[model samples]
Target: MRVLGIDPGSRHTGYGVVDGHGNRLVHVTSGTIAVPGSLPFPERLGVIFARIDALIRQTAPHECAVEDVFMSRNAKSALILGQARGAAVVAGVQAGLPVFEYSALQIKQAVAGFGKADKEQVKQMVRTLLRVTGRLSSHAADALAVAVCHLHSRTSPLCRQVGEQR
Candidate 1:
């Protein structure tokens, strides 16, 4: 199965694609969609939506895995992050892909075997799992972790809880 993973942010949304079969997972592509800070906040969301839409069309992923909004000390920041996540989710749903949401802890644990794994650990594990040699930005690594988490969860009963359809 081909899965697209998204780590959404207002300024830089990261995305990664992976193909998984049985116990094998192969990295396809990963990159960040940078939204200029000068652009209006709403316009940034439009850019995110459009880029994710284009990515779906280009990659043809069978499913999508997205990071869920985690609570932040700043309520406003959390709200904006949620909005960015919503835009990405909408893009996946519009493309008829079953969307699965994973918490940061879930993603980290699945990829690195610890819920509180540091970013460097997560990055290294993602590179190891996908057998990728190129450098991966933190955001792209997190996105790939989300996809790996989904691949791990999809065969279990947790699949029903994580897979959200709109």
Candidate 2:
């Protein structure tokens, strides 16, 4: 199965595509959709949406794995991140793909074997697991990790909770 992972940010939305068979993972593409800082908020959102849409069309992923929004100390930052996440979801739905969401802790644990793994560790694990040699921004690598988490969870009954089966 092919999964598209998204790490949404107001200024830069990172995305990656991973193909999984059973428990194995293969990296397809990874990049960031960066909006100019000078652009207005609305325009930046538009840019993010367009880029995400294009990515979905290009990769044709069967599903999308998105990072769940976490409460932030800064309210403005949280709101902007939420907006970007919304746009990312729309892009997946528009491309007729099923969307999956996972918490930051879940992703870290799945990818790095620890919920508190740092960014560098997560990036390294993603690179190692996907066997990717090309350059990948940390944010994009994190997104790819999210997709990997979903793929693992889907194949392992132990990872499923009671309510998730429905």
Candidate 3:
């Protein structure tokens, strides 16, 4: 199964593509869709939506995994984050891919074995799991982690049971 994972941000949304078979996973691509901060917020959202749409068309993923919005100290910031996530989710749905949302804690626990793992730890774990040697941006690493988390969740018996129930 080919999965596309998204870590959405107003300024820099990250994405990763991975192919999974049973317990094995292979990374296909990972990158950040950088939107200039100078642009208007609405325009930035449009750019994010367009880029994500393009990515879905290019990668043709069977499913998509997206990190859910987390509460922030700044209410405005949190709202923008949620908007960005909405745009990404809409792109995935429009592409006709099964979209799954996972919390940051879930992603961290799946990739790093701890919910409170730091960015460095998550990056290291992603690198180790994907057998990647090159440098990866934090956003891209997080996106890859989301992909890995989805694959892990899909293979879990409990998750499968829950999914079937739904």
Candidate 4:
């Protein structure tokens, strides 16, 4: 399965594509969609949606996975994050790809074997698992982690049972 994973942010949206085959994962592409801070929030959201829509058309991933919103002390920040996620999800669905959502803890645990793992640790684990070398942006790494989490979850017997029950 080829999966496109998203780590959404108002200023910098991250995206990663991975090809999962049995027990192996191969990195396809990863990058950040950097939107200028000067733009209005609404325009930024439009830019995000258009870019993600174009990306999905370009990559043709079979599935899309996104990291769910994390609880934030600032309500405004949380709202912005959720909007960004909404843009990504809409793009995926419009492209006819099945979209999946995973919590930050679930992504961390899948990548780093710990729910509370730090960003650096999760990045390191992502690199090691995908055999990715050289520099990797934190946001891109997090996006790849979400893709990896989906691959793991889909193959898990427990997850399959839970999903079937739903």
Candidate with maximal lDDT: 1
Candidate 3: segments with Cα more than 4 A from true spot: 155-166
Q: How many collisions between residues are there in candidate 3?
A: 0
What would the per-residue lDDT of candidate 4 be over residues 53-152, giving only the tens digit for each residue? 9988888899998988888999999999999898888888888888888888888888899999999999999999999998899999999998899998
Off by over 4 Å in 2: 155-166
**For each candidate, C-alpha RMSD in Å?**
2.0, 2.9, 2.7, 2.6
Clashes of each: 0, 0, 0, 0
2 or 3, greater by TM-score: 3
Score every model by TM-score: 0.95, 0.91, 0.93, 0.93
Predict model 3's lDDT versus the native. Answer: 0.89
Summarize candidate 1's per-residue lDDT along 1-166 as a digit string, tens digits: 9999999999999999999998999999998999999999999999999999999999999999999899999999999999999999999998998998888898888999999999999999999999989678989998999899999987766564334453
- Give the TM-score (vs. native) of candidate 4: 0.93
Candidate whose TM-score is highest? 1
lDDT (C-alpha) at residue 96 in model 4: 85
